[model samples]
Target: MSFDDDPGRGGGDPADDRFSTLGGTRQTRTRLPESTGDPYGSTRRPQRGSRSLVMVVGVVVLLVAAIAFANRGSDSGSSPDGQSPKKPDAQSTAASGTKPVGGKQGGIASGYAHDEQGAQSAASNYAVVLGSEGMFKSSTRADIVRATHDPAVVDGLLSRLDQAYTPSFFKNVGLNDDGSTPSGLTFVSRTVPVGTKVAQQDGASATVEAWCTGLVGLAGPGSTKPVTQTWFTITEKLKWVGGDWKITSSSQTQGPTPVSGDDRASTADEIAKAVQGYGGFTYAR
Candidate 1:
């Protein structure tokens, strides 16, 4: 995360949607009151104030070029929706040696605990898990559902979700239920948090909304599910549980996204090949 010249702080890294309506007897649900948080809230994230003084038009153009360049990559490289990766973060690092370290657990995110940034980081990371490929895999889904979400929603949400993941869904992701091999396809399901903000914060709790983009697709021969992009916001109502931020409840909604550019969409096979051939990084704050 070098801040030498780029703004967006030396602005970031990337990857990459939805919300639900409420129903009666469904328990108390708090809809995320529509607030965009602070899109330009770099005041808290800055280590020095010197950079803020310069807002060169050429620099803004440079930043835009940088963003576009950073986002250009394969499906395996970014948020499922193919957005740019999270730029270098000042707070999180591979050296931080955070949770579930390297294994089946390698995908587990860490570094959040008591700090306000930590709270927002946890919510942002958890939001990614809440919307990943694991959600469609029965066993993996169970593990993630338990680790990231409220316990009450685990069972019912799982049941309802199971119904939603039809053969059509699996076919789209190049997966076959029973968690077996789905021929030559590489299944792609991932969520990338573009940016996170502390909508409201206090010592014991925080509300962090992770703006994200995602992909749910099949990456093999003869598959119809095109790897498409989606934009959504995930508002996590977090509680400082056991010294770590845990999601008490979370909800989603559609885009606060910008218009798409004319970048050439990659082919299903090219996307699938990329997914299978590549791996993911452990996202940090």
Candidate 2:
């Protein structure tokens, strides 16, 4: 079964809204009133003072135009060709300046630094593990729970998760009662984090959100459940424990989804081979 097909599973990805600025100068043109038959039909000559005033006004207009030209030329953000640089979006997939944590526990990234970036990193990696195929099995699920969750909530979370992935649940998803796939079928469940954000943080705690995409299902010839992709956001409340970040609680919500494209689905064998050839990542902020 696909991850999103299960009612208990949560899904989503972050959506970004972009905005642009527009600017223009309004010009007011003044014109002298046309002569109305030149009172008494007499031709009039311009006075010297009137001519001098017109010269002054013309000079002022030229000075203002020059200043406007100089200001535009001095805009550092514009290129030599006069186009403004395209600003980067607020959210990006680029790597953060902070270095990733150097330690690992139970094969998962651990020992994050004590900062908001650290919390974001921890949340991303935890989201991957929590949404992985291992969560469907008893032994590996326990290991994952213990590795990612705070010690205080470990037991309770384990019990709840164990009940959630019952034998009936396994059977419904094309897996055996013990959570094993049938012969010649490969069960796939993987989550890749797109980006992370620290929603709120303090010296000892943080609330982080992880936007992710995942693939889940049974892949093989004649498989009833074909591999499918899903997007989701995971919100994790973390606490500083044992000198590292640990999940105190977590929840998931369905997507800021993108429009689907028209593409052909690959054969089950191809999907199975791709899953085997690809390796998962240890995410960082």
In order, candidate lDDTs are 0.65, 0.82
Per-residue alpha-carbon lDDT of model 2 for 29-144, expressed as tens digits?
Answer: 22345567787665445323334656899999999999999997778878778998787785456677787787999898999989988898899889988888999988799999
**Clash total of candidate 1:** 21
- The superposed Cα distance between candidate 1 and the true structure at residue 130, in angstroms, equals 1.9
Instruction: Please state the error at residue 259 of candidate 1 in Å.
Output: 1.7
Q: Per-candidate TM vs. native?
A: 0.57, 0.69
In candidate 2 the C-alpha lDDT for residue 175 amounts to 91
The residue-by-residue lDDT of candidate 1 on 1-285, one tens digit each, is 233442232235211001211121122223343445768643433232333324455689899998888767423566767885787775432333434222223356643657666776687668777777777778787788667655656688678778887887665455675544467766677788887777888877788888889887766678766667889998888877655666777789998888999999888778977777876654545
Which prediction has the highest lDDT against the true structure? Answer: 2
**Model 1 reaches what TM-score against the true structure?**
0.57
Candidate 2: list runs displaced more than 4 Å: 1-93
TM-score: model 2 vs. ground truth: 0.69
Error of 1 at 244 (Å): 0.6
